[model samples]
Target: MTTEHTGTPRPSDAELARIAAELRALGEPEFDAELEATPVASLVRELAVPTAFALAFGPTDSALPAGAADPAGAGGLLDVAPLTELDRARVWRKIVARRSGGAAQHHGPRAPSWRATWVAVATAAGLALVPVLSTPDRAATPAGRAAAEALGSQARAALEGVPGEQDGGRAAELAAQYSARLSSSGSEAPR
Candidate 1:
């Protein structure tokens, strides 16, 4: 059975011309005499392809060859312009601009956020560890000495009655052994 026509309103002549212009802007590389005569040229206007979608497909032309069918007198409907190097460049520029709000052109490559974060973290870590990793023999300032004393006091408070209160002698023995090892290894741990 033949399918019934829905009689959907076709795109207006202006709309068709605009579509043709868009196709011309994005068509293939060249629209020579021989290429236009091919079925591909007619198919393009009939299809009303958008520039970005078919830009890679190469150029086409709407110029009907000798004895070609002239169903509609609208020249724009048959017109498929060829894409020149400059035209291709322009289309590409438009595409890129559309995608990135033209920022890619003004700004080159961007440093990744994670890389910047890592750099900041590394700098902070280096600064924080500098004092602890300084040469041990250097004389401490009053503030430095006070800070060191406070840290030592905190450590003593934490370990005040460590293994002594925990178990009879096992923890004390372990602590004693650990202390002896620390005293034996004279070089301070690296930062």
Candidate 2:
């Protein structure tokens, strides 16, 4: 089945593979099938997947060969300016900085409002009380103990009564009995 994209025609698998190999030699790897199926322009807008893959497979310094163009000239597939080692390094640094900055922003300290502090205290107290609340009632009444013992006995008896055979012998016997009953009732069971 063919995937449809607006703006440009999709490249054949062979062409994509060839371009992917060239990009790989340059340090970028081929896009996974999922990414390849995405419209080229949309892929470029996301930036991370294509940029990372290009950096992995495409040359760091020289302009990408003309053969490297995807049938759809979505900007992600081609770079007019060849990337140098320095350029690649810069890109790597920026990527790292963006990631770290995001993390730092997420983790940065903030003033705890009174409501937040109260919530935190309440959560802590609730967590601390869990063990006390969850502790089983060890001192059962004599009647309760007797009832529990009776229930346990019934469970054990039920388990013991169940057949544990894995072979179809029991099933076959049951089926035969069912068939016999059906025949006696003058009805044919479905095969």
Candidate 3:
């Protein structure tokens, strides 16, 4: 893919270098002084690692030969050229491309839809509960007994204050029936 620039032309390398020199000349005095005072060895120790990674899995090898070459090229400061306008532009373009192209292609497996995810979760729950429900004597389990007791108490509480048309013992009869069923099976009675 190509990005065609339609805005103002990018600055040339010489112009970028001149501007960088001017900015350096106008540097913050305190910060520049502090940086100058910081020893190179201390700065190297602090900035040796670009990331928070540490060697974890490999065997220990602290001792190296007297004149072993630095394979990682971390012996001293690298001789690097100043960044030009083109470098800055390229970096900006990369960042923009990453942000815009995030949704353009699927990197891995496509995610399931919300509805499909819910359906899958419900199916798994139902399957998991099948054996528990099918147990012949559910009240035999401690969890089932606890559930039955909780249900019976809730039913009695619900029937406490409702007004009835007559003095019929309907509420008492319902509560008794629910208690009996719970004592027997720890499950709701069939409709």
Candidate 4:
């Protein structure tokens, strides 16, 4: 007599339990293989060259040589003659003299106008009153101070609990473990 086997293979209870335990114990996979395969160096070079070029050339506007609306002529459109060292020095002296003359005229003795005097007094009064009006009256109540202190203490405690230095290292390790597990198990972890 011939015997026939039918239907799908059924996993035993023990086998199922073992599989679940393995799943729980597994962490993320090492993504080193994928990272190694990636052309990270080339990508870095690609990103750096353009950024450096942009910085060296300044902004891409009318100010830049390439970004100019018209590039047919050498230098800029302005036809101002190039100044010699002597010419520049003379021009500088004239500008200085004009500025000094203006300053002397303004500072020379003069009676203050009624409108100017009142305006100066009003401006001084406003400046004096600003700090007084803007400053919050912290001494107005004891309850407000107590609440602020309590909130500050709570924030300090929360900040203290954070593992500052080891945070990035721990995160990287966790990510690697997760990737490894997902790869081995052939399942995508939920986001």
TM-score of each: 0.18, 0.23, 0.20, 0.24
lDDT of candidate 4 over 1-191, digit per residue (tens): 01111332323322222222221122101222221222221111111122333454343321222222233222221232233445434433533454354334444333245457889999999999999999987683678878988999999999889865457987888888888888788777635
Q: How many backbone clashes does candidate 4 have?
A: 11
Ranking by TM-score: 4, 2, 3, 1
Better of 1 and 4 by lDDT: 1
lDDT of 2 by residue, 27-133 (tens): 32223333234333232322222354445445443223433433444444443223345544543454345445433544434233545788999999999999999
Highest TM-score against the true fold, candidate = 4
Predicted candidate 1: what Cα RMSD to the true structure? 18.3
Model 2 has an lDDT value of 0.47
Residue-level lDDT tens digits of model 1 in 14-124? 333333334344442333232244323343334433444334444345423323333553344335343445544544454344435323322434435556788999999
Q: Each candidate's lDDT (Cα)?
A: 0.47, 0.47, 0.40, 0.39
Candidate 3, which segments miss by more than 4 Å at Cα?
1-109, 113-118, 138-191
Worst 10 residues of 2 by lDDT: 40-49
Residue 27 in model 1: shift from native, Å? 21
lDDT of 3 by residue, 1-191 (tens): 01112333324423332222222232323323432332221222112221111122121122122233234323332322334455656533533444234323223233345456889999999999998888787335788888989999999898876666334587777877788887789576545
Supply candidate 1's per-residue lDDT for 3: 10
